[model samples]
Target: MLYSQYLYQDDKPFKTTIRNYNASDFNQLIDIQKECFPPPFPSDLWWTKDQLANHVHIFPDGAICAEVEGELAGSITTLIADNHGEDHTWEEVTDNGSIGTHDPNGNVLYVVDISVRHKYRKTGMGKLLMQSLYHLVVHLQLEAVLGGSRMPGYEKVKNQMSPQKYFEGIITGEHNDPVVSFLMKAGRSPIKLLPNYLDDPESDDFGVLMEWKNPFLEKRKHFF
Candidate 1:
C-alpha cells in the first residue's frame, strides 16, 4: 500500500527499502538509536553492539529496518514469545533488550524497539514497518502483534488525568497522542495501561500495551 511517498530528502522522495537488517547495519543502527533517543535518556539504555548482534543471530526474521541510499532510515526490532496476557516492563520481557528469550513457536510477535530517525518521521516509514509486521504475523500463523508504546503526551496532562484515563482518552478519541494514536490507526488497540514501563519522563514512566490481532487467525487454527 505504501507504494510511494516515503521520507523526502532535499524535497525529493528518497528511495527507501524495508528489509531484514544484517550485521553490516550495526553501526548505523547505533547512530540511529542516539539520534532517536538523546541525552537524559540514559546512554546505557541505547542499543549496544552485542545486543544488536544477538538480534540478528537469535531472530533475524524479527530484526528489520528501513534503508535509504544504503543507509538506515529507521528500524524495528522484535522477538517471538507466548502471549501471557499479563503486565510487564520492557526490560523484563525483552530480556533487557538482548532478546535472548525469542521463541519461533511463540504466538505473539513482540516488538522490542521501533525508532524512526528525527528527519524520517511522519513520512510513512513507521507505517510501512508496521505493515510488514502484520504480514509477518499472518505468515507465521501468529495470533497478533504486541508492543509497549510510550505515552509521551501523558506528562503534559498528568495533572489533569491519570495515565490510565489518558490512555482511554486516546482510545475514545478524547485525546490525540503521537505514538499511541499512530499505532491505533495502524489497526492496534490498547489492551491495558503499563505503569513505570520505562525511564521516560515525557511519558511519566507510563506505557500502553497494544495488540494487532491477525485477521486470518481462525483460518490458521482451522488448518492446524
Candidate 2:
C-alpha cells in the first residue's frame, strides 16, 4: 500500500502513483491488457474478475498498478511462487493467471503479467512499476524476482534463426526486443530460454526467463 515516487510527463508534470490495485481496478486492468496486447495475442488470456479477486485477496502486495492523474495507466502482477525458478510454462507457474500457485512465505517473486496502456508507453510507467517491485522484494526479504517474458520480435526472425540465437542477439546488443529489451534496462537479465511457455504467436510461443536478484540479500552474503 506504500506509494512509489511521483512521475512527470515529458512536457508537463503529472502525479503518478504505484500501489496495490483493488477490485475497482478490475475493469481497467482488463482494458489495459487489450491496449497493450492487440490481436494475435489471445483475448481469452486477459484477466477475469475472479482471477483478479484472488490476486487481491491472496497477495495484495504483488498486485500493483500505476495511476496517473487519477487514471489507470499500467499494472504488474506477481506472486511468491512454488516453482523454485524452474523452466516452467507460464500457465503452470501462474496457475492460469489466477496466481493460484502463490506461496506467501516463498523466496521467489514470480511476475505473471505487466502492461502499460499505449498512450502511457515510453512514459516511464513500466520502469516505475519495476522500481516499486524492487522495493517489495527488499521489504519482504525475498531472494529474487522472476518472469517469463515474451520475445515478440521473434516472429520476424523465427525463419532466420533459432529462438536461442534471437535471445543471444538481444543480450549481445545486436538485436533488441521492444518489450524484453526494456525489461533488461530495468535491471533484469535473461537466465533461461523456454519454449511453448505461452500461446503467444507473436513470439512463436517462445519465452525467456528473466531474473533480478535481491541486492539486499546479496549484500548480506557477499563482501561487495
Candidate 3:
C-alpha cells in the first residue's frame, strides 16, 4: 500500500503518551512488534517477565513505549554511546558485531528499532514515536541518531533490472513504500548500502543506513 502522507504529519490530536517499558508491558509490546514487521523478532527475545528486568539492569531508560487512549501503539529501543564520529552505529551493530559500546559523552543515540502497529499506522504514530525519540536524544544531550532501512532487491524477469535501479525506484516512491517516504520526511538520508547484509543470496535487498542530526543542537542551542 502507498504510504499515506497524513501518517507523517504531527498536527493530529491523538493523545500520545510516553512511558518507560515495564515488565507487564513486554507481551503487548512484542505482540505489536509482530503485527508491524515482516520478520519480527522472536517472542522469546522480548516477551517475558525477565525481559524488563534485564533491560533495567543493563541499560536503564533505553526502551520506551507510546500509547494512544491506553493502547500500546508503538515502541523504540535506543543505546547511547560516545561520539562514534559517524552516524551509522545501528548499521555497525548489524554489521560490525559490537552492540552496547558508546562514545565518550554519550552523544550518539542509536535507535535500534522503531515500530507501530498496522491499524494505527497512517495516523502519524510512526512519526510521533520518532519525535519522542528525538526528544529523548535532546534530553540526554545526544549529538545524532541513526537507523537502517531495507532496500528492495532486483528482479530477473524477461527484462532484468539492476539492483541499484531497483533500490532507486523504491526510494523514489515508484514502489509506493511508505516506510521509505517517512524516513525521507524525518530528515533521514541514506549513508551507504551494505550488500548481502542480510545474508540472503537470492535477495538483493541491501541495507540503507540513515541518520538525522538533532536540529536544536545544530543551532547551538541546548536540548533541555
Candidate 4:
C-alpha cells in the first residue's frame, strides 16, 4: 500500500510505504537483520535469504516491507497459524525459524519477524509496519496477531531481576526496553514470558509473548 502521510521520529521526517516483499530485497533484508541483531547471533534466531524467499512463495502478501524514499527501511514478516487454546514457543511455531509451518488457512496471524535498518530506526518505520499488519488483520478477518518480543536491554539487569520482575519494570517504566515498550504502545498486550525462547543472549535467552486482538472479532462476539 502507498503510505503518503509522513511520520516523524527523532525529529526526522519519514515518508514510508508498505508493500509486499520482493526477490530483490533479500540482500537488504539480510543487512538489516545483521545490524539490528548484533553478534552472539545464533543461526536459528535469524532467517536466511533463501528461507525468507520461501516464505514469500508460501504467502506472498503475508510479508511486508517499509520503504522510505525508495529505500527499504524495515520489514515485517508474518504467517497464518492454527494456535488455539495453547501457547507455543517461538521455535515450534516458526519451525526453528524457517517458518516452514506457516498454514495459509489458519485463523491467527503469527508474526514471524520484524526489523528496521539501524540508520532508519527511530524513524517510525516499526510502527508503520505494525499498522500495515493491523490493516492486514482487518482485511483478512483474522482472529489476532501474535508474536514474541525480545527484552533487548535485559542483560544488564538479569543478574538482579527475574524475567517477571523485568517485564513489570518495563511496563511500569522502571526499565526501558525498546522492543517491549514499542510493542506495548502499538497495542500488543503481553501474554507471558517465554524462557529459552531464542538462542540469542542479548534477549537474555527469553522473550515475551504478545498479542493484538482484532477489534473486529470483539465486535462480532458482541452480536453473537
Per-residue lDDT of 1-224 in model 1, one digit per residue for the tens? 12223656567777788888888999999999999887656778899999999999999988989888777889999999988457788888899999998887888899998888888776778887888899889888898888899888886799999888898899899999989998888787888888878888878887799988888866532111
RMSD of each: 3.5, 2.5, 6.7, 2.8
Deviation in Å, model 3, residue 49 alpha carbon: 5.9
| lDDT (C-alpha, whole model) for all candidates | 0.84, 0.86, 0.58, 0.79
lDDT of 3 at 126: 72
Candidates 3 and 4, the one with greater lDDT? 4
- TM-score of every candidate relative to the true structure: 0.90, 0.94, 0.70, 0.90
Q: In model 4, how large is the Cα lDDT of residue 181?
A: 87
Better of 2 and 4 by TM-score: 2
How many angstroms is residue 98 displaced in model 3 relative to the true structure, after the best TM-score fit?
A: 11
Q: State the local distance difference test value for candidate 2.
A: 0.86
Q: Of the candidates numbered 1 and 3, which has the greater TM-score value?
A: 1
Candidate 2 or 4, higher lDDT? 2
Taking all chains together, the TM-score of candidate 2 against the true structure is: 0.94
On TM-score, the candidate that comes out on top is: 2
Residue 220 in model 4: shift from native, Å?
A: 6.8
